[model samples]
Target: MLVSKKIPWVIKYRPRKIDELVNQDDAKALVKAWLRSWESGKPEKKAALFYGPPGSGKTSMVEAICREYGYQLVEMNASDYRRASDIERVAKVASLQKGLFASKRLILLDEVDGVSGVADEGAIEAILDLIETTKNPVVMTANDPWDVRLRPVRDKSLLVEFKRLTKTEVLNLLKKICLNEKLICDEEALKFIAEKSEGDLRSAINDLEAVAEGAGKITLDLVKQILRARDRVLEPFEVVRNILRSNYVWQAKQNASQTDLAPDELMQWINENLPLQITDPEDLWRAYEALSKADVYMGRIVKSGSWDLLAYATELMSAGVALSIVNDVKSKYRWVKYQFPSKIRLMTQTKEARALRDTIAELIGRQVHASKQKVINYVLPYVRIIFDNNPEMAAKIAVGLNLTDSMVRYLTQRNADAVLNYVRELRKAISEEVKASKPSKTSSGTSPPTKGKGKSTQTKEKEGRGLDAFFKKT
Candidate 1:
């Protein structure tokens, strides 16, 4: 039986011809003209650069156009070839080679902006060399052509901008997909996804797929769940701005409920930015008072495990806080860039530092006969001082502890690249050690069955049974 493999919706529904591309008529026309110029032996511009925000169909359009015109597409990402020598070895050869069966070639360098600094030495020069010498047309795609590194490529190529798909265009595409799949989907849900996508058709399609999983019908609630899980949360600044500006309770409540933030996180954001938003002293004081009450409700909810109290907590934080502003002072509130809560930022940093500290303590405790707490309090300070003074010793300790590059950097305050290189060497050594330790097959076709924990396989199985019987009695 031949079972067909299931393809992803993104690939399955992707446009295979240029005309099928949405809201990119100008780009399509420009590309078509550029490709047509190649028939006369050489175009005025040897290459065309397609640049736009991701999921705007830049790469897809170029590929489809090449396929439609029977041109052989040679695709390469900039990340794959970082050095001048790497580019010269692969791209230079590929560019000069003629396609079999009279098919014209098109070399595509995708995400050219990623090649950077020491890694990209001579890469730009090599690409420029190709532009001057290659008979075939070259195409490149990037999210940003205006990026400083891509200037040389931009100068050598004809720039064609791919604009984002309009909301109507995206919604129509979603509706068409739903019809093709024969999946029931709410119109409002589709529209919401389209609007929220902010012109990225690819993201909207992915979101639709996620929401439609394991379901015959797609509901607004299902769409909301997908959006929430994806963290398509309300921007804190926007939410804070609206809350302060809203005069009616329902409007404030609506704004608050729409956000993915819990009451506590939302309260922190408001607490951080409220003073800047409101100029009136009395309004500021009133808002803080409402926040205090919201905190109290949150504490009670925590103590009692009363999830139903969350609604009351949200109301106090949002509507209560909004209504606290005096009537005359309501119009005084103006939107500014909301500052992130410093307390939250500090707490996050502290948490990460504590985790790293605990990891180190645990590693040391395992080697020496002591608790993690004891190692942390009694030994870690001396270890830090030793690591600070001796780089070689630090590297040895890091490998012995099987510590990651990030952990090594945090503890020793060494250069990131040096720490990463050391960690990589340690990992390679460990991998080689494991490979060397594994038993090799004998001259016979079949290898002997392996023992577990120095016991024969059968004996290990018996011990497993005995442990199971012991556990059952307990």
Candidate 2:
């Protein structure tokens, strides 16, 4: 019986040492320095944050380092340690205690930036706290370090950036893998795969494995075929051009299905360029009408979790939108450059602002004991007004809520320096007030026991009325 080789090429050929990692010398050096510091009993930085594009050797490098140095790795992905309690249970325990067999422990939080919203409440703060007190070293990896959610974590950890692998480097790695696998691969085939991978070495290797899985030999033609079939393979512009110019419904549908663009994404591209392609106003209206119907189908699919409706959504968006153009004005469509969807562009531009808004909403919900929706709809507008009218009150609220500088600036639409100064002043004042409220020591240098102070009945009623008035403005 011929036993199958089950090990995936990507995993089987993973780098085993620091020197084995490609195009990430700086990252390797930083990680080595961090490890050496631990040996000296004084770490320069307790945590190292690795940020880069995917398929780079961030995770592999950390794992290799831990292996080489005989450190126990307590690894957890974002999904596993999403909540603060989860982090405390796993990471906190790992950090506070010694390893079973290894000399030292390394807490590896992979894709640290993936933690988000309600699920990740207190996660960043928890990580920051861990880095401060953990006897073991902590390491984190993220695709985007500048993510607003990661700002606190970024500040606490030392940042190590991993650059994308060069095309030549990727090509060389593929050749080596092919040689080891004993698959006869042509130079042009390997080069094509490397160029198409766009500096993602892992993807290049996976693609090579896929093409050479059962084939006796790899050729340039096989590489080209695989590249063409890759998902979302068609450029948005070309897909839009074909959808607009094609007369046959089947041809338009085939074009839509062949390319990797999802139905909704294809619709956006078509919607953006349809008017520019079709000169007639009636055709434009009809095209938009088809798109609207397609969106209705999409809504149903989302609500019902029924993927069967996807066919209808695709047909309506593709052929239905294409058929709306009755006039044979192919000549006019040639000169127009396809315009990208403005909505997507706007969303990309305001991503950070939106994240800040959601953060503020969550904070308000916790403080007011209201749902997030209620806080956003009924309370946030008034809070903005209050911030504008009373800076001191706004500063106090910000401090009370533990709002970050970025959050405050985004919500108040103020300068960064101004927000930072205001927050600092408010924090100082709050600290002083707390100091004053504490009982003083007697002549013997011992404080006297006193009755605990609680909110008075009248004070509670007055506060209730104040909140009532606040909501009335909203």
| Top model number, lDDT | 2
Error of 2 at 327 (Å): 48
Per-residue C-alpha lDDT of model 2 across residues 80-99, encoded as one tens digit per residue: 66567788889989998999
Candidate 2 residue spans exceeding 4 A from truth: 1-4, 116-118, 230-474
Root-mean-square deviation of Cα positions for candidate 1 versus the true structure, in angstroms: 26.8
lDDT of 1 by residue, 408-435 (tens): 7667775445555655665566545434
Candidate lDDT scores, in order, read 0.75, 0.76
Give the count of colliding residue pairs in each prediction.
Answer: 0, 1
For model 1, how many clashes? 0
Residue pairs with colliding backbones in model 2 are: 232-260
Whose TM-score is greatest here? Answer: 2
Q: For candidate 1, report its TM-score.
A: 0.50
Error of 1 at 93 (Å): 0.7
